[model samples]
Target: MSSTAITADATLPDAQPSPTSASRSVAEVLVCLPAIAADALPTVLEAIASAFPGEAVLVASSDPPANASDWPSLELIPYSNARTGVGWVLAVGDYAAAAHLAVERDARAVILLGDDTAPIDAPLLRSLADSVRTKNIDLVLPRFTLGPNDALVNSGLLYPLSRALFGADIHFPLPIDAALSTRLAQRLATSTQRLMALNQGSSLLWPVSEAAAAGLSVREIPAADIAPPAPPQDDFNALFATVAVSLFADIDAKASFWQRARGLPKRPSGQASPPPIAAIEASSEIHSMIETFHLAQDNLQEVWSLVLPPQSRLALKKLSELSPDAFVMEPDLWARIVYDFTLAFHLRTLNRNHLLGAMTPLYLAWVASHLRTVSDDPGRAARAVEITASAFETEKSYIVSRWRWPDRFNP
Candidate 1:
């Protein structure tokens, strides 16, 4: 897969001049929308207009709306390489095209808005833009309000792993929308180009890891609940495997940075509480998930033996015996299981797909336990999440040791 160039389409006759043309007009902010439906463009444009009034804004889209000429302040630049409508996360091609346009226009800040932009409002847009423009922060990640059962994969593994490894307390590492300073955008562009050169152009980008590796400051702002795009495939196993493989590969790549001993950053004070979510009945779901785990325990012992240590395997055995009402997977035990699997992924203890596939039952088991815990007291959902992440931070030493000496025996 050779590296491909992202060329901007010519400006519409009625629209403003191209940002790359002879005028050389600078844009204060560059907002890149991977894809936008014709009907949704008005809402997006109206939000942008309200958020950034009387300022030059460069709007780049793979699918530009027909009425782009109405917004004189917005100079539309079209690019066609982005993998639009694939998923919520921005693809490598999207970042590459946005970076090219940002550099061309000398924009001070860039906002990468993934496919769904209808939910974004004026204040949210302003917060993302102002963070990069006023403050010196390099990356601004949005923390969306979610229900107790929502984003289980992220809550179970992604948030805790990233928080523990990168020392970033962001609730959502894989966000649909984010704000990036010019320098951070350039850095991401370089990384994307390198991945493209290696024939991994369609791979997902880890912005949090990139920012952490570059020693850039990061901040997470409260955002209204923005719904992520539905999974391209309905299979939960495949989706979990895909996300875990990407994250494990990222962890393996940044081993040097996270291996060193470091203090965890203190949580910000006076944070606003998230709005309440309606309670959901999940007893049936929990029972089904528990059954899945029990089946996997009986069937996948050989595959599990290759990755989990003796103690972790014993822990899972003990957990599988409990009934759904009595089931509870301790945070510490879950952390160790994840660490061992990550090590297995790094060492290639088994086929990567098979390794991640075996993890699905374990993850479902954890989810069942988590939902059971939070269902008893809905208000404790936030505290439960905090405790889970804290356990990961506490167990960081365990992973560091196993990573350094994979062959060493453990109890």
Candidate 2:
């Protein structure tokens, strides 16, 4: 209801954490930091220290500063990073270090804080640990104060897809500051390690999916974090491709669990409303986005024909015919498009990279279509995203039937 943790009743605080279970290591907080420049390290450490004073904080990074004699009760575990980008950063060494600290220190709980995330303070960090230690919760996710325009990818894809597939309602599935019990840490570590061993170290690990599949406890805490805008050098197509590949791969790997997963996401009610975001609908790029989609229609048609049902193909064709002013991708149509793409990804109808790459423009079209449809109100974009997620849930059976009998077909 208030500051949250998405439990049955108004996040996790309403139920109260179990004191007995969390008492084992109250003073220890395993903080996983990202590799940063030397000039910035002290300020970062200070922010953490101020927020969590007098605690044994184990700060792990792929690379840590040398000559760190100044900080007390802070131990450094330097690890080797497996890949680049967020997936590489979070899934590779970062996750392993947290899991290691959780076991070795018999730590009460592990808190993941990213350098690029919004500032973390004492109360927020403590709140995350409290949820785990006091509430005896296994997973603690952050409920951020986001501007509507931020986290578009998470809104469009990660949140809805994860919700429909796993029935986990974490607002930010790939958070930099998530809390975890010992059990969750170990579970994530095992998953991460397998990916590393397979030379798929760049693979992303889905914590919410893992937690849901294992039936582990999960909670949420309030965190003040605003994601920064994309870097100038980041190409839209490439960035979207990376996330799509990871998501599709994750879905394929856990197809069985998601296939059986049912129901809408559990969105907690009554808290501060989200901040306003830019209307994709109003963006000058609608024509550009639509143009991209049309290009894909011409370029990716044969591949699309193989992946999509005839019905889906016809729907996309209709949308392609509309000008930006009139263009709209219905929620159901978008869902089927995504489901078909997921199926295509699984069936390896084309090269995986090219397959995911093809979906990016289609994704942009949906974003444009969604923004065009929703209101300009501060939280309306979120609502639009939510509606899309609901569409995904409603259409999940389509995913199931296709996933189960991918070949025995007609639409």
Candidate 3:
């Protein structure tokens, strides 16, 4: 999640404003800018300042370099929560602390950013800020256009499942960069601060779920051009476990909210456009993915049985029998498995960490099946992915039913 680099010719408006009277209420926006490489700070800072104006901006920095030191609006404070980190390599906890800072500064609009990807210009930031000011938008999330091969976990499970459950069509629910209206920011602060008090500041927070549960206004803006964030150092399994556990925990907490939510709301479809139709696996890695799935079936069948119903187990067994060259995990089957597993997680069917860990190989199986099926033109693959998401939406009733009665026999 990042913005395109700022051009040298681009200049921020330096025009300062006249002072407002003591009795006049000055409206301010909160800007949370993380430390980036030296050359990029000037452009980002200037853009933030320009977006808010002379006297109505409060910039929060964890420990900005000396180059950003001269900015008069900078509030360089050490946030303990900013120091929080999720296990392994997922370390994006800046949102919680930034929300707290926004509340402290009494800002009407608050933007939190990760150094990985940010907007280099003011217009996008202005667009988010204006939506908060005039359009009644409470949470402004950035929609990033990822490559077909990129962000597979999000493309496969996280995004689709989130959309199905929460009814917010935001592509990236936990985007590193976002703008939050005062109410939403305060809600985020409440979540993060509570985690800090419980000595779990390192735990993740789900803003989209929070907004949905509160029935607040949510909006999405395009950030397809932002350069990818700093590459993660963690490998996929640990990353999967960390993130899945966090999401499952959030779902568990918000079960009452999502279970009550009915049909998906009719709203602007802010999804990213279809990417170029090129095979993700022209030289396909289906073999390795299938191998992993096979290994899981052999070793973890007993564990999976506790979570999956007989029908799903049978589908998985059949998928297991398919040769690597002929492998295809159906979209509907995969959605059902995810739903069953989520229900199991909520029911505490087994060790939470192990439960999430077991999901990794099955996910890899889906990827293998996906790459093989889309070896031709990628348009077919995109359509298939859409079907998978639709399946999740269509199967929402199953989740609601099973969630309410975990011990009962379900399809």
> Among these predicted structures, which one has the highest TM-score?
1
- The residue-by-residue lDDT of candidate 2 on 1-411, one tens digit each, is 011111121211124332355444445677766556677777777776776677667765556777566777566655333333553225644565556546655676888765443355667877887788889888888777666556677877888888888887777776655788887887776666555455554456677778888888776676656443343345767767777887788889888888777665345543223223333444676677788899998888877777788988888988889877777787778888888888888888889887887788888888777667654454677677777777777789889998889887544
User: What is the alpha-carbon lDDT of model 3 when measured against the actual structure?
Assistant: 0.68
Q: Write the per-residue lDDT of candidate 3 for residues 1-411, one digit (tens) a residue.
A: 111221111011112222234532344677776655657766777777676566556665544557655666544443333433542221325656566556555678877665434456577777877788788799887776555565677768877788889987776776666778888876765555545555565566778888899889888888656534533556667768878887887888999988888657533343323223333432446677788889998999889888999888889989999876667787778888888888888888899888988888999988877666555444655565666677788788888889888778543
Give the winner by lDDT: 1 or 3. 1
- What clash count goes with each model? 0, 9, 6
lDDT (C-alpha, whole model) for all candidates: 0.78, 0.69, 0.68
Considering summed lDDT, which 10 consecutive residues are worst modelled in model 3? 5-14
- Per-candidate TM equals 0.89, 0.82, 0.82
Residue pair clashes in candidate 2 = 5-11, 5-12, 5-220, 17-134, 17-135, 18-134, 18-135, 51-122, 149-277
